[model samples]
Target chain A: MSAPRAEAVVIGASAGALEALSAILPALPARFPLPVMVVVHIPPDRRSLLAELFQAKCRVIVMEAEDKEPISPGTVYFAPADYHLLIEHDRTLSLSSDEPVLFSRPSIDVLFESAADAYGDALVAIVLTGANDDGAKGMRAVVEAGGRALVQTPESAFASAMPRAAIDLCPVARVMPLAAIAAYLLEV
Target chain B: MNGDPGSEKVEDIEIRLLLEAIYSQYHYDFRSYAMASIKRRLRQAREHLGFPTFSAMQESLLRDPALLPRLLGYLTVQVSEMFRDPSYFRALREKVVPHLRTYPSLKVWVAGCSTGEELYSLAILFREEGLEERTIFYATDINQDALHAAEAGIFGVDRIPLFTENHRKSGGKSSLSDYYQAAYGRVAFDKTLRRNVVFSDHSLVTDAVFGEMQLISCRNVMIYFDRALQDRALGLFRDSLARKGFLGLGAKESLRFSKHADAFADFVREERIYQRRFE
Candidate 1:
């Protein structure tokens, strides 16, 4: 059987997200074909340093997603702090200030469900090290849309609850280490 | 946010129908809002309101007039923080106010004023800057409930701390406490702060331009709109502003791609403030 292909990737994480994401974001080649959209739980009060911090390390272009901006390949888009990121059918990025889901503003499930609606089977979703189960519903959405889902193994994660929940909700998601997930991105 | 959108799924069809229903029955023209936001809110509405689907929601909405306001609550996001993005307010106080002072009397429109957080922030800023006496503030929103709340200017005391901190960061000249009295877990802003303020029921989506203004502060409200609706609202602002008047938008919003981009130039690029252009 042939390996499934994906056009874009969406990642969700909360606690321990920085270290877990650092391993994968910096490893992608400059010419990476797919765009990576990431949602990390950060306090709404502080301006995020994720884009600036990752831009210096990642070979691929890294920046905070702006509303109505078209999805561009060879870039990684981080959800701006405190706004839920969504993908439109036209592939333009949209941000929402609607009530937070699961006490999270930039919700993983919001991004994943919208991306699934936009990309369907051509999407790839990842759930990484976190303390909360924000990404579990998103994982299920991706899986139900026939998109591939990768969950960081609970034992291998810095915080296991999030990844463990993703597994419980969407068992078909590939259980892998962060290294393998980075490898999977390179395969694109 | 206006060209024909790509609506393909059964859910999309249902949503389009629901929006149409909303417009015809309630006169709320959400048909042109950004599809992604509409869809997101629809999902939330279905879950929270216990509608099995958009189809069911639409049916309930058509028959029950009482359901419209409840649904509009979900459709329009009313939650906002006072003095949000302090830098934006700081830039307004430092950069934009200098130009406004040139005019003997000023008009400032707070489009989509929501629950008055932004309106109160601006009112306090103007008052501190000594522009309050000369300024007439117009605050407008589509939601009547929100307009009433904006008019009342009372907020839970729990929100005051962050508001106070933000006010401080925005180069507040006077203490935030000077403007309001706290009691019973709530603070009622001195009504005198709103003495020059006018709160109105207005929808940028359907309403026409009203009154020429020296400045218009319509922030994050545009992020809810599609690209086309944004252009329409921008056009209205362009028409409404006096020559060389200013416009302030949300932190993430910009005029770079709007059809009315030529009507304004970046005043404080970092703060998304723009100045009306001759052309």
Candidate 2:
């Protein structure tokens, strides 16, 4: 009947994700309470500029996730280019170079599933614009773990396959435009 | 009040018991590893090894002594390459080698040297710097199969081009082709490159310091360890390094938060190279 209280947010995006992220990340004020973990598909061979680029526009702290590093509030952590980012039981960030899932190294499914395990009902997961179905199973896991799942309306997304996949996989909490999703995040 | 019944799943309990069985029976302690990755790997081992669950895997492991290595293969991560992260090697060549050239002799330890790619890279680097004649390299890893592969010094031929490019980017003094001969779709590196190298089975989780060294290049190995295990490995490096000796880690690892952080000073901060400092 009411919105679930969230302690953290997990976001996944692929193609056309940078533009979508740039739109949403700036909407959250500096006093945002929840820690945000993100996995955006990037080329494995090169370094990532997502953290640097996002930090300049977002009011909250933004950085790449590091192994065994603790998660902190008001900070955004992007999964490193080649490593699968996971959340430990102790609520710290960890990175792994295990075999890729769904042909992606920093797989959205991996991050979402792990965050669901660690945060349970206190987690909020978002599936954004992407070209593939990497986040479908992960959003399913979030809903199963008593967490909330939000999908960008497929028609509103630049690349609709990912959000459409999430919508098909799970009965998500909301399907909204990018601006409305950002506004919902602010409410949390 | 001591235990939360809802939070602990049967799968979680079985995994903890499996890790305990592994440590108690085989003396390989993965009990303290970060649980999330461990869980993922164990699930993988379960599915691949044809076991129904972690409990089934543990039962077979405790009864069969021969299953340890196969399970260890699953437990240890073996992803590596020749000149992986070329910038780190470039920094080693341009920044660290100058200091090493001053020493008459050098001992270099490639801790967690998976398949010897890193050891060979350093061996070739020393040879290029004209320090190979005066240096001895200790290449160590926990996986015996990987150690054997390292000693063999052969890699698929397909990997050579990337390795060559990486070598060139690392300020290589000679053609990478000069170091290996290609045959049968594989490249067999020159045995002379390992003339002063010793490949050994060592576990950073349980092993002790074996020798004092002028340099230790242990990149990307600590990412698998928990905070305490990482500290233990860093402590070994601290104790084994000669005063002012250099230590290099994976791009993501840093000593800023380690318990042994005080023993090392940042040498090449951008490259994650640290030098042992004497009090």
Candidate 3:
């Protein structure tokens, strides 16, 4: 297996992602070296409780990155309401009220593209269960940036369209079940 | 009002008529708000008004002055909370307050200050920061009822806990309860907070600049406007601000890609706080 060395992980998931995230985040050990960033599709105006909700489920500290907050390893960051969360040069977060892509701010594509730029070869991009094709382009960006791309196997995902879309767009490294992904990440 | 096939033209014409009537009768221009949001609100008003058609609603609006208030209620989204978006308030306290202290007498405008949550929040912020004595806050909105509600400064007791938490989150130096007195299922904020606040009718859409200001907090209201209207509102903010004055917008709104992007640099870009570029 050509196991690409992964230092940071970016996960893009939509409607059915919480199912996958629940399994993946809790399954990772406390000593995991990589940081995780997630973009969950939601309406722009409402408040997000993803950080608080995930904190109870996972060992890693979960937080919404304030603009310019440094992204640290072993912590997980979720996008805040209505703002696209991007990675700055210093590995900190940058937020923009820029126009929505795929009718979503905090878009999966925005996060994945920025993560690709920041972490390049050491990045691991995951496309989980989602109803739409939002993460496909960004998943390709991850692969093109010399990062590893993984998709939840469609038959195993809660929704298959998103992972299938990514598979179509790029030569995704693996289409693993959600449980296998967590274990694989730990070993690699 | 319900619309069948071939209703788009009638809707447009009716909207223009209602807007023109509002302009001539009320002198409140809502002509430029994004068509979709406005239409949605108007539709809600029609449903509430028991009118079966836009034409019927238009006739009633044209005839009854009181109906305008009901219409305004639906059009103006007054959803607000004290210390809403606590981090933005925290940023203002840390970054903008110091600059405001330099002014001997300060004027701050809370433009589109729906229901005055941001205005009262600012008042509390100013008082705690020791700038209240010299500051005059002009809290303006197009909705008369919302202005009235803001001027009254009463909030539901149920909301106090959340608001207090938000206040603390914004780094309050004192107990949030100290700012308001609980009575009869409501809490009346302290009069001292509003000693310098003047609530009045002002519309960013139709009204010209009234006075130069040291700071303007127009949050959330610009999202309803299209880019042209956003540009116009931004221009108004630019014009109303003193040299090096501050501008704050909603979390989801920005000056980036707007005509005024270069006119102001961010104080805290994440919080959408900016200071006018004087140099």
Candidate 4:
């Protein structure tokens, strides 16, 4: 039997995420085939500089996701600070400010669940370091939709709560250290 | 309401039927809204309105006319603030206001004006710019309650601090306190500020343009719409705008993907403000 291949990648992180992201994003080559979508918890009132900061260091193009914009390959899209990022059936991006879920506007669970619905089995979801459990239910959703799920090993994470919660919900998810995650992504 | 394994599919169908019923009965077209948020709001409504399922909620909504306002309340009210994005307003004041000053008389349309925060912000801005006497503002929204609240111009006293800070950041020439009077935990913005303003019921999804506008600020409203509906609203804005008029969208909203993109030129790209093309 052949293994399923991923068409796109969605990642979620929170507290102490910038360090974890720097380790992963800069390692990807400019020619990476799939689009990457990310959600990192940020203050609702402030403008985010995540895209510009990552784009300066990473080989791949990075941009803040815009509403109704078409997803592009070889580009990384970060969710805007105050809105929930969603993936439409047509593979376009959308933003919503209806209400915050779990005390966060750009909720990891919201993005992960929506992407799971959009990409189904072709999706690859990753949960990284965070102080909260926002991504646990979302990781489970991704796994249930036949998508692959990966978590940073709790011991290696700067903040272990998020990965531990995800592991509790999705025990079968492949756990990798920060350094190995980049290599595994390159292989995929 | 039971969490059965496949209840997600069942709930989706029920939501569609409920939206269809609301449209057919109320003539408020929400059927084309972005589905994810709509589903979330419907779930919230179903739970808060004490219905076992969306079907029961739809049945009650159809039978009781009084339920419409409560349901609309859930579907429409979003958290908003005066000068929510200070930088966008600063761009408007610093960059866009110069071009707007050229017109002898101006008409600014604040579509989906919510509870009038943006409208008041612009009104105070115009007053400070010494253009208040020459401008007429149209503040519009689909929610009757919101429109009424906008007309009243009363905001909680607790919100004054942030509003004051935002106004300062947007280059206010006068004190924000100069525009309102406080009483009993609320502030009633001076009535004279809205003397030249009109608060009306308008829906971007169904309403037609009532007048040509020099500048139309419709921020964050279209994020709820689907592609076709967004294009339709953009078409209305394009038609309503006078030659070389301006349109300001929310920070997250953009015209790049719209069919009407060709009609606009980036006025302040970072701020999401666009100018209507001469051709």
Best by the DockQ measure: 2
Per-candidate TM equals 0.96, 0.96, 0.64, 0.92
Clashing pairs in 1: B1-B226, B1-B227, B1-B228, B1-B229, B2-B228
lDDT of 4 by residue, A41-150 (tens): 99988889999999999999999999998898889999999899988767888899867888998999989988887788888899999999998998898999899999
lDDT of 3 at B252: 56
Give the per-residue Cα lDDT of candidate 4 at A39. 99
Residue-wise lDDT of candidate 4 within B1-279, one digit each (tens)? 225756456767788789899999999999889876676678788899899999999999999999999999999987688888889989988898898899999999999998899999999999988888999999999999998999999999999999999899988898999999999999999999999999998889999975779999998999999999999999999999999999999989999889999999999999999999998
**Tens-place lDDT digits, model 3, residues A1-188:** 68567778888888787788998988776667888888888775478888898989888888876644567888888988777777643476666544578888778888887778667778888999999998898889789878988899999988899999999998656899998889877876
- Residue pairs clashing, model 3: none
lDDT of 1 at B181: 97
Q: How much is A87 displaced in model 4, in angstroms?
A: 1.2
Q: Which stretches of candidate 3 lie over 4 Å from their true place?
A: A1-15, A18-188, B1-13
Regions of candidate 4 where Cα sits further than 4 Å from its true position: A1-3, B1-9
| Interface RMSD of each candidate, angstroms, one decimal | 1.0, 1.1, 10.8, 1.0
lDDT of each: 0.91, 0.90, 0.82, 0.91
| DockQ scores of all models, one per candidate | 0.71, 0.74, 0.04, 0.65
